[model samples]
Target chain A: MTHQQIRGVYSAATTPLNADNTPDLGLFTGHCQRLLKEGCHGVALLGTTGEANSFSSAERRQILEAALKSGLSGDQLMPGTGVAAIPETIELTRHALSVGVSRVVMLPPFYYKGVSDDGLFAAYAQIIETIADDRLRVVLYHIPQVSGVPLTLPLIGRLIKAFPHTVVGIKDSAGDFANMQALVTAFPGFSVLAGADPLLLPLIKAGGAGCITATSNLVADSLRIVYDHANDQARAADVEAAQVRINAYRSLSNSYVQIPTIKAMVGLKTGIASWARPRPPLMALSAAEHADLATKFAQLP
Target chain B: MTHQQIRGVYSAATTPLNADNTPDLGLFTGHCQRLLKEGCHGVALLGTTGEANSFSSAERRQILEAALKSGLSGDQLMPGTGVAAIPETIELTRHALSVGVSRVVMLPPFYYKGVSDDGLFAAYAQIIETIADDRLRVVLYHIPQVSGVPLTLPLIGRLIKAFPHTVVGIKDSAGDFANMQALVTAFPGFSVLAGADPLLLPLIKAGGAGCITATSNLVADSLRIVYDHANDQARAADVEAAQVRINAYRSLSNSYVQIPTIKAMVGLKTGIASWARPRPPLMALSAAEHADLATKFAQLP
Candidate 1:
């Protein structure tokens, strides 16, 4: 109850793309607004699920701005600003701050894996010091399976110790509940957000703040219910039902490559064909795959 | 050999840094010139050894331009321009072509691991097609251990078939000689460069085009000797002796973390401390480590 900075369910929102493979800003903005309307605490845009790393620096900046300019408040938006290059990370973070957004989810300088904790610390310290923005809040990203750069407990402790105010939370996406539980036990008053949908109820019960998950893009209502009532004895049944619905969505999404499938599901849920199109290096679902998914998706709770 | 396209010893040049960790453009250009003078065929700046991903897009462009401005010809420079983001990769590559540097080492879009071959193929095809420059000649980068994205043989075949002229060669930095040999066997007229120092002689013997190696940063003279005389029976002894020297340098570089140690050894070789200052996310060798390396470095053949 005491250890939460970023609370409740945030949608690890998927960005829609036009035929030309550029971010469909209007569609993207609408999705962000819908996530908020659907009970997401915030739109955590440009995360891994959002394919932030797949987009160029310019495109990332544009996507963030589109979200804010389309009437989402700075407080309701938490865009991912990290990239392989520290300078660009700085540039992106500064752009967010310049546009009145303060919170960002940042992956480490991920291109160089097997890097020493000293180097990783230096990278983050330099970024925070260089930015020198007191309003900034960074949720340290721990998606080692994807980024290939793990934020170990010691590293997270050091980052928290050094930049206590700025480094407020983390999104653990490794899908290991034991590891997530360990993170919660290790850090006090720091948010530990589940990066997976299935863990939302259990994590919230384990004193985690909430989640920023791809399933929230589809089942934000259920995720919100789970987050809000995880500790309530009377509401346990409702929360369980919500959790089941989320698991159903997550299961179907994982049937294909998670991110593209999630996007395809979002398109199905919204009836927006553009939602199905992903940028290169993350192929959009093939026609038959999408049709198959659509049929299965129709039977989801 | 008839299969070779880009044939020679190319140094995966270690970029020198200022005290602030910015690319010391003058020193970097100087190192490029010195690498060429030391008998390297060309300076392959901004590969992994160059910490290219650690640098911003603007910084990457500057590093490439600095080499050209300092009198290196287009044919004498092959910069690595691929990055996690497809558009940035395109931007960097297009910048290289715009500046008359046609040959560039390109890594596949690497953020999404376990990606489908179709997605990977679409990724490369999009970049190549979007660039659409006839002058462009891509040396596919296959460093799975580092980049987390391997340019598989099948993927390489697909790319080469699609853009036979543009996708001309590959730098197989996976350090897997079997993979390198397989690439050479499967693709005729495709240059297969060894990513490690020790493999140069054997790869050349097995029909690899040449090498783009970190050890070449310190032992370019030896690598060039091996590349030139690997197959000549009359020079076998000389090549063996040179490779032995290259191995000695590489061993000491690996005595600590390879990249920082290579930079430190480059400093030791050139009597320039600036070479030791890597950007954040790559720590410089400690003074004690440098002193120890210097002691052993002086004894190398």
Candidate 2:
């Protein structure tokens, strides 16, 4: 498969669900429009950042349909459809492909750890064979620390070899620069998208395609500018410095609060004052946290 | 609210599925009969050890129904029905209660970690309110290292105080002896079961009711003997030695292969090699591991 359109900063936008906790189609549509307007190269809907697995199959289909209807083209959209079960993941991926999403990021069947690479390969093989979509662009999502399922080089090599056309890239959210660089270097033709915003410049310089980061939720435009001017040394250093401060805060709060903190920043900047309503099971920041975030974000350049 | 029945060895058995991956109802029936014959107090089905989360809701219902049909009474079974989503978990749990399985082990909504106890309370509250089953006896399953979600004492105190009648007990699988002792000491009346097989003696000596252990899959009879013969110092030491051998093997294998490894041991003892087949994403061990286990088993008391 040719590495043609998989480059630059791709924003994994949050799915704005309605008050009923269903996909807020209107808000999602508006968010996509705003993301594109704010200068993201493309958008990845229903990712961890987008909380894709939180929605059921029907809700997922509905969200995708609304995205297409709202002028979000497939060429610019990569939706997360990974599930614990292969059938469900395939069903979701097939739907995405049918709707013209050439690139689909996938999470490994993550419930089990220390799982054999063969099992993961079998899963991918089953999915690829079942879908049989020629335009299928599989980007393996590697967030081991969260999923407890790590996508190693041997597994990646196997998938890419078997479905060379289908498996074109990986999203290294391991948050380890060494792993990110290894991915870029190991898979020459494959697009290795950095999952952290801070590593964007280093990864790009190390032959990475670009980044699909969480903090991109609040800083899409700034990240896009960084991606565009990465070759310019002075500007690149400044971008890294800003990201260092941001990541320092992320480390303090625990990266699990990335979405909420980003949303808090978004509300602060836009004056919308949204409550940073993380779904139940993932608690929303307390009042003190909200106030602290606002004050801290105010100090960011 | 009085703790009556939860004081003995409970084996969280694996559901032996057929080649088609459907529940092997016949195998399970036989398995249950054997466990009862061997003198286990009760059996916990669809637990993390049983890959409960991997099975669909329909599968869980079917398995529970089969167990009921096979003469396992409500008092003799504890089904694990917790998932990431509250509504689905509630639905499945309510079904278990209705079908006469009053004792249900509930895992915390574990996918999202670093969540506040308030969120956990809301989740449990929703389940209790929706089910409204007077017979409901909830045993909170605490295995934070795997689930990425921890159940702190404050949350436990709040739940027990608020729903004294419903929140009957907890299975402290944190594997930390101090934490388990704290739970046993703090909730004097509440049934605190040891989650670790190795800690069974210590926990029992410290006011714990019994153990809900994964290793009970292979050594239920021995565990039962030890529990019944707790006063015999030499016998308890023998049982502890056997448990250490099993647990050491478990730790050496990283605990990821605990289910399959135990099943392999069962297969070796019963001459039912089909029992070794673990579900996809969890492959069966190779010949080398089988040989190693055989050598280790010979050294066991």
Candidate 3:
């Protein structure tokens, strides 16, 4: 599909870790259904917010299975399965492809720093060669700030040129619009996704695909409207206003806490569950932080 | 056991990837045996140099099995089992513990940046509590520059105090002597190993433990001698000379290629393998870089 043709808001759903800290399969399915019903084009589970890195391969498979059980097919899901290791990444990606999850968003191996573009190319090359499955559609995940492993413009362009069909798109979560524009300008039809919710309209206007945003976990429907009417001059004010509101909220509390905070807002609004508990090392939001987040979110249009 | 204890040079061996790129188990065992004979304290298999992040759980198990088959016990080996996810970290840590591999170094869940120490504490706390196994001895792998997840002083203090027994030590690859000193001073009995080879004397004089170093992969015997004789002025000078020699060699080439370059040099010296193939996204050293590295090594004492 072309870049413009691939436009639609994608909710990067939060993977609910249970009280005992296992993958809460039941809650995950409910969340997926809610997102789909709210009109999100698809759900990208296991992104940074989904805590994909914190899950085991078996656990990853189980979550993917649970999402499937909820009737979210390959088209409705793009699972995060990339790892620092090649074998594990290939194993997860292959399994994802087998379960009809053709579209996989992969983070580059980010453990080692100062790696060259040549090295990045080698990693992607090895995966495409090993999978050898025509059904697999890889979306290069570019979240350089966190991954420390960047998907540069040249590297993205090279991958697209080498394996046009396999590497169909990219999710630019670098939060840098200049880089996003370069991708949009460089690869005409390649789906260049805006990973930041705030950049949805500008990115779409720059000939890019929709966003797979973290905040969309809370405000997905509004994000969907923003994506659907991205080019509408009449709605530009509303879109810019909403983006500003979300950005303001993110600036206060740790944006890394956005996952649990989004889930907290979801619980407040829809009643799937109460007490949004993020797994430790990442604590549940404090009363003050939550109260603050809720007050600001209450201000959302 | 004590703060004054746990001193020696530990080699983080490289897992030799075969021509087909499958982990060469035989070469792995051969390297381990050679390291043990070289008078090294233990063999740290599947570390960054070993490309721990590049292997599957099954592959990691196989390498561990081969090390055992070649006569290394669990206590004699420290495996790098940290994943970007908690469950995988638990699985690998549990497996290592089950196999009697007690000393498992863990990297923080690194896909997200600016992660609150509370989030990191949550990750480590969950692993320790859930495992509920007494045999587990945790070593925090602090390589912030690589993982983008820094294990801050306060976080370390919290983890040590909370799970005193389970949180055994830390390998500070930050390469900052002051940070290493703070860790040494704070946790009285904690094993604070320096990640940088050159910091051994300063660390040891400061009541630090042994080094979990990459360069030891090439020169374990010399590093061991230096580490053992750190107290003696004459022997310390010899050690300092060797450190200078090794550091000169490392500095000549692109420091980015340190892991593969060191592995290649080891392979060259031992003749057990022809090439040091780091996993994808990390290519082999270029011919010019390789020659420069070789020239610098020849000049080492």
Candidate 4:
């Protein structure tokens, strides 16, 4: 598929771990399949919401295999293949490509803070060179808030110039529309996916691609409505109305830790308690918080 | 070894990478050996200065094994075994223990930001419980500036209370002496190693353990003098004078990226240009910067 085809609502799907903390492959694949069926254009597995950094390389491969075997099409999946180590990133990215998965979102080596643009360029160049896979397509994951490493426009421009086909897209999770607008305006034809749900309508309206957001796991059908109606002059008000409600839902849970709150919402919807348990360093929502969330979610239109 | 013995000047040694960016095990082992022989009480391998996060698990294991095989005692070595993944952390920690290396400095699962103390506790508990080694000892690594995850005093208190024998010490790299003082005063008898060279005298004077500083790679012998004379009333003024000079050197190179600056300094000392090549995320010092550093280093008494 071309870069333009890689658009629309993509769920930053969370990985469901068993009580013992191993990836519940059955649950994970089932969730991805459900997200696809629920109007999500695709499922972005193993992104931050998926706890990608918290799982071993071997475990991540197993997850990909399980999702593929469960009938999820490679065309509808984008796995995060980034890690602090370059070799591991290459291993994950190469494996994804070898299995016919073309598009992968990668974070820069984030351990070092305040790295030079030259260093960041060298990192991407090294990965592209080392992988040596012409078929490999990279969506630069730019979430400086969490990663503490920003992929500045100059670095992105250089990478695109050097490897136009390989570096085709980016997921701008910086939560700043100006940055997203700058990116979308600067690279007209590039696939610029908003990482936040609230930016979906504005970003889509700004000659950009759709979103790959965490809330897509729960609200993909609603987000898809905004994406589908973003450009329709008659439906402009309807799109704005829908986006406001989505933003309200996002704001309601803004007080809680994002990943676990989303997981708890999923658990409430599915009646599966195990879905609520985020791996360590991401605490599960407290009993009181979960009950309150259920009440608030019920109140949402 | 008891927590008390885990003291004095420990170099947060830099990992020497070869021309191809792979860990130079020969050079790495040689560097560790040299640090121990040059007035360092012990060698702290795989800390930030060592670029531990940038190397793969297999590579780190190789480095540890090489150091041990090259006649370095486990008692004189403290490896940074923390990784974003809990299983990977356990594997590395268990490997260190099985090889008779007991004391380890571990960073929290740092990829996730704003994690709760409970969640942080859960992460550590899972690792300690999974490893299930009675001989396991941990020195919590708190460099919130770099890790973006702070190990608050409350969290430390809970961990120590829960795992008194297992959580033995901490290397507070917050760069705030007040925080270090709180840690030292709050937990009397706990090993609190300062992470900066300038804090070595004050930290040691405050009943804290000596430092595990990055600059020790180049100035271990001088740091040893401060550690040795911290309690000497007559030499207290003399120690302060020496510390001012060391602090000045640190300040001169503060404008450059830290890991590469130290790598460049080591290269200048050893006359090996290859030692100056940092991994991808860390750029090497510019020629002008290196020349300036050489001149400043020469001015040191």
Candidate 5:
């Protein structure tokens, strides 16, 4: 992987919220430490699974500060600093860079629908220029299904051409393997992290960076096993079979909401009831649903 | 209209950004004042047209404060208090209420896609409970095309049933006339503000409160004419004809991005170049496009 700064398995970790919906800083910091110990290369904090957009800019900055104060190293963190606002995005990105976190995954401004590629490019350009930090490394986030904004190949190429050093990698969360493969083929030597867990092995084998996925939150050690041995022919079948099982687990719970289901799984695994509660607009799994998921999760190979 | 707190044509005003992309408070206040003078009943600051989500929480609060200081009455202002975060939304809503702005338009938590109605209800419920303000009057914003979240009638009914006084109105920007009509029919006496200019006449005829439209930013006086006479059988044809012209203008410039084109029109009309520049992720219209729009705008009936 050419973009080694952001290679290997990363978890788009879940954000634990208090009863009043405030970020649980202590729990979040602990989760980061746990993710690192569970075999994740780094934790992609505030990514979709973390409910990044659901927190205010102040809260996000405070969470970052708390995480750092609690002994989480910048090298092991890549916070999702993207926002609908350019200045706010710059503020978060600058804060991340100023604190020694070099790489940040950013979503394009997503509030406006049917925005042009030029608009999207101008947004990234402004953030880059405004931050004006040479050390700033951006891993573009592409999850059009949710954001309603796609970072097409042409746009990605243009961004890279304009700022080759600053624009380092991309997390293709489109969940289309073909799109991920095309991104890998188009930007050879560029870090192409898969957003979906099932594609982790294929993406690693395709000369790409590892995955930054939500599933890695709970199964980082498992994902790292596949990532580490993706090139080993002897482990190829086993990795594929394990991926299928992981995919099955993902599919079963994903039939419900992803963030809440993942939270429920975390609660079930850790026996932390509060972990099952997602912020509003994302309901916690029902007792029955959690029981069913527990049975299915236990049944997974 | 039954909901007098938010009746009549309102401009979903454009947020004026300074050269550095900061909210130009003076410019915004001037625009609001001008809208009022031009026959707008009120100004809906920070709606989709106003690029509400594209600014940080602090910036949004500052803009609202400036608008108030500039002598815009809270009675005639409905600032959008919606954000992806529940606490932030509650904070903004509480600020609006505390400052005497009883009516505020709110968007559902839009970051999570395919969220259940229960989840959406939870979000509003939490906000209402947390805010705990009897004076707070919320006008739900349903711009599914942009927000990627719809406030279906059932959900709206649920919110109203839960908090009838707080959840007072809806701005249906789904761009679906049928949806707006359904909302109006389903919730008799509930305020239904048309989010599109073209639907203003029909919506008003169908018992909608009025339109809170982007076009009202520029053509408030004209829209007021249609809204004021929507039920007059003798003037029905005239109102429909005016709506057709408004729709034409919207359609023409919307062919080349709505917000930027409107901003360009404002610049052309006022000779303020900065008015045309949208915050990043929203590129300004090229000189050529501006010229074309100017010609089209002039030719409008």
Candidate 6:
């Protein structure tokens, strides 16, 4: 755990939007607080589930600012600052630091596919160097399914070697445990956070750090229970039960288009209908789907 | 031809960078002027070939503004305004409109993959409605290889039908002639511009509206000749010869990583080595690759 710079069940919090589709800042910050109250270590705001890419840079800055202004300490937040372009990624990361948030989850410059490792390394190096700050802690984001950019082992190693203190962790959302295991094996002390909910227990047991996941948006308490006592022999039954609950929430969330469904589930969890509204390119679930989900959601552990 | 809204051999011009990697505004503008003088209908600056996605929004605006300031008319500069973020795309497009430029090659919001046609439709529809500029003409960019988001035919049809005047054309860079043919067959009046160089002749003959291609950066005259005389029975040999010349340049460029090699070849063509510098996430050719390419480039038509 010496290299466990970021260790906990951090919620990849889904953003709550108003009827006009703008981010409902008040609702979003309240949800962040609830995740914390329920045992989330930190709030990974502005992630895939949060629909960060759909919003403008100004909105992204405002969302992070709003979360901070809501009284969440900087260390309790890890915002995704990576984007298709390098300058904006740098700007977003700097913006996070300017507001006292030091840790950031960054995706690679994802516009070009099949880019050489040299090219990717150069992009990251240039960005990190340009935003030269000793306090910066970057958790590389590897979600090839969504971003079309996979942060490879060699690239991660290069980043770690170049900026050992700055580049601390990774959010392995590729949903591959083998990859996470390999990352743990390769880089000791470098945090390996699970991007999926179900893997958090196994990953933590396997010398991995923790998780920054979507299901945590709904079942943070269960995840926190699992994380707190996964290794406790006397609490083995509790761990198993919490895991089942987390899986139930994850399964229901994945039953529809994942992000929108998670937002809807959040609405059902909090009894707030506006929580169901996702921005464009991610539609709100239809009435029939919502009813079906509500039935299944009620039956969860 | 009758339904052609955007018809011409528009060079997807390669942007040259200075030593510090800033857009060499002077060289870029000169390249645009040269592209026009060499028979290109317009300079499609800040495109895939131009490495538009690599630059920040501010940089993209500056490059486009530099072209317009260098005496290129608004009609002769089709900058790529679309990005993964819709608001920035809207802002960039609006900026273009404000400067008297109407047409922009817009890529779909590309961060999320396997998104539904409905979601994508909503994204573009919302952006267009938000812009709400009558002078705005968007040429939908469809390069699935580079931009993971594909502008499917159904989606394109919906866009054209929804905003008949604003949604004017498509840059079909999937390198699939069959898809281009289907688009031409399905949407008669919508501009179906070839993304590849060799397809220009066949696409034009098959009733497509010219091209917006990378090779046009190197061999604009040949592409211009092919477009101007594809239907002229007397100029059949000229078109064939021009197409052959165009293919030669394309093949050499493709021999290496396409964009950087094209930038390097542009350096060779203009005898300014500075043209070889590409922004990060896109590397310059090694000295050896450049030397080999230079030798072969000298032998090209």
Q: Count clashes in each candidate, considering only residues at least 3 apart in sequence or on different chains.
A: 0, 0, 15, 0, 0, 1
Report the Cα RMSD per candidate: 1.1, 3.8, 2.5, 1.9, 1.9, 1.0
Tell me candidate 5's interface RMSD.
1.0
Q: TM-score of chain A for candidate 5?
A: 0.96
Q: Lowest-scoring 10 consecutive residues by lDDT in candidate 5 chain B?
A: B1-10
Ranking by DockQ: 1, 6, 4, 5, 3, 2
Best by DockQ: 1
Quote the lDDT for A122 in model 4: 93
Ranking of predictions according to TM-score: 6, 1, 4, 5, 3, 2
lDDT of 2 at A144: 82
Residue range A1-301, candidate 1, lDDT tens digits: 5657788889999988888889899988888888888899999999999999999889999999888889999999899999999999999999999999999999999888899999999999999999999999999999999999998999999999999999999999999999889988989889999999999888988889889999999999999889888899999899889989999999999998889899999989989878888887888888999999999999998
How does residue B250 of candidate 4 score in lDDT? 70
Q: Residue by residue across B1-301, what tens digits does model 6's lDDT show?
A: 4567899999999989889888999998999999999999998888899989988899998998888888999999899999988888999999999998999999988888888899999989989999988889999999999888888889999999999999999999999999999999999888999999999999989999999999998899999999999999999899889988999999999999999999999889889999999998999999899989989998987
| C-alpha lDDT of residue B143 in model 5 | 87
For candidate 2, what is the DockQ? 0.36
Give chain A TM for each model in order. Answer: 0.98, 0.92, 0.91, 0.96, 0.96, 0.99
Runs of candidate 6 exceeding 4 Å displacement = none
Q: Is model 6 an incorrect, acceptable, medium or high docking prediction?
A: high
Candidate 5 regions exceeding 4 Å error are A1-3, A237-241, B1-4, B234-241
| Per-residue C-alpha lDDT of model 3 across residues B138-220, encoded as one tens digit per residue | 88889887777789999999998999878888989888899999988888989998887778768887888888887777667
For model 3, the stretches where C-alpha displacement exceeds 4 angstroms are A1-5, A233-256, A272-275, B1-5, B234-237, B244-256
Q: What is each candidate's DockQ, to 2 decimals?
A: 0.89, 0.36, 0.77, 0.84, 0.82, 0.87
| Candidate 1 lDDT tens digits, B1-301 | 4645688999999988887888899988888898899999998999999999999999999999889999999999999999988889999999999999999999998888988788889999999999999999999998888888877788889999999989999998888889989988999899998998899889988988898999988888888889888889999899889988998998999999899999998988889887888888999888899889999999999
Tens-place lDDT digits, model 6, residues A1-301: 4647899989999988888778899999999999999999999999998899988889999999999999999999999999888889999999999999999999898889989889989998999999999999999999999888888999999999999989999999999999999999999999999999999999989999899999998899999998999899999999999999988899889898999999999999899988888887778899999999999998988
Give iRMSD, candidate 4.
0.7
Candidate 5 local Cα displacement, residue A151, angstroms: 0.5
Give the Cα error of residue A179 in candidate 5, in Å.
Answer: 1.6
Backbone clash pairs for candidate 5 read: none
